[model samples]
Target: MTDRQITTTLTSPEDTCALAARLGPLLRAGDVILLTGGIGAGKTHFARCLIRSVLLEDEDIPSPTFTLVQVYDTRQGELWHSDLYRLSGPDDCVELGLTDAFETAICLVEWPDKLQDLTPETALWLGFDAGPQDDARNLTLTWHTPRWDTVLKGLVA
Candidate 1:
């Protein structure tokens, strides 16, 4: 797997949404995204933007914090959003059906550390950090999949 880092700052929720909008077009059905960050790091906010943009709809996309997972169907395919913060362990992954999701849909997982050995090897990782102050946020994206490299190039362009 190849490791690369991309650091960028987002000023507001709109800015975060804009970045997600730019990246959303590159996602495919089998893509997986692992989001890592502390509380208030804007992981869910970024994901909401991503899925909504991909669906081309301006609907309310709530964080699946308690429900654990949410699915959206777009013309491209299914988009699955999962928040595993409340998971007991990797054993819970099968219950969530993540392995199958990896092959059938585009997945965005928050609190990815909960699934130690279950996250797809080709999954793209997006790490978030709180900015200096206010509502600012810093995000770093990395991926090992060849498809991700192509997407990264488009994002960087």
Candidate 2:
């Protein structure tokens, strides 16, 4: 399938989290979300919100900056939260077994631009941009396959 994209301006962490919550209902067991954004752009916050929406357990979802990856067992499925900001290239992705995670679970990866070479054609690209004011964010959703076209529509709806 060809790529299809959508963009949305989000304000506040709550707004970003709301988007994540909305996305939660649309997710299946094996979906990949590649998130790109600068520091403080709310990527980790969004990830946390997404996890909270699906995780059956009441636990904190920490940013995996140092650990590299954090795994959470959710009601929907296993959620793999990966932070690739420190990664140098696509090789790091392969070494970290991310390709396998992509195939096996619902993977939410931050700083995915680092894995440019390995970004799959089936993965969904969700970018966060700085907004006009502090505490505001802009999320741009780009789909690499038609599989997400309906999902994106639901997000907007």
Candidate 3:
């Protein structure tokens, strides 16, 4: 099937987090969400909110910038949040066990360009960009597989 997409403008950081939390409950293991955006585009905030929404307790969710990857145990299963910006190539992902995690865990990946050919065909793609307002962010969600169709059902997302 063809790709399906939805675009929305987040008026503020809270609005961005709200959207992330809205999708959080629909996730399951084996789901991959590729987050792409420039610096300060609200990627980390959205990921932090989504991860917290699935967690049973409150905890700090830091950007996996220098750390590369952060794994959390959630109600759905293991959640892998990875920032591949520092990686020189896709081979680094294999060494980090990210290729396996993408198949078994609920993954939210930032700087997914580093994944190269290893990028999953079933992954949901979220692109973030700056909006007219300083605090506003334009978010676009895109998917090629039918998996996200069910996840986005009823939400008109």
Candidate 1 stretches greater than 4 Å from native: 56-58
Per-residue alpha-carbon lDDT of model 1 for 22-141, expressed as tens digits?
888788888999999899888998898889888845577888999899988866799999999999888897888987999999999999888888878888899989886688888888
Better of 2 and 3 by lDDT: 3
Q: Tell me the tens digit of each residue's lDDT in model 2 across 2-103.
A: 667777778788888998998876787669998888888888898999889998878977899999999988877788999999988889989988888888
Off by over 4 Å in 2: none
Q: Which residue runs does candidate 3 get wrong by more than 4 Å?
A: none
Highest lDDT scorer: 3
Model 3 Cα displacement at 124 (Å)?
0.3
Question: lDDT per prediction?
Answer: 0.85, 0.85, 0.91
On TM-score, the leading prediction is 3
Greater TM-score among 2 and 3 belongs to 3
Could you give the C-alpha RMSD of every candidate to the true structure, in order shown? Answer: 1.5, 1.5, 1.1
**Native-to-model Cα distance after best TM-score fit, residue 38 in candidate 3, in Å:** 0.4
Can you give the TM-score per candidate against the true fold?
Answer: 0.93, 0.92, 0.96
Candidate order, lDDT descending: 3, 1, 2
Candidate 2, residue 11: Cα displacement in angstroms equals: 1.9
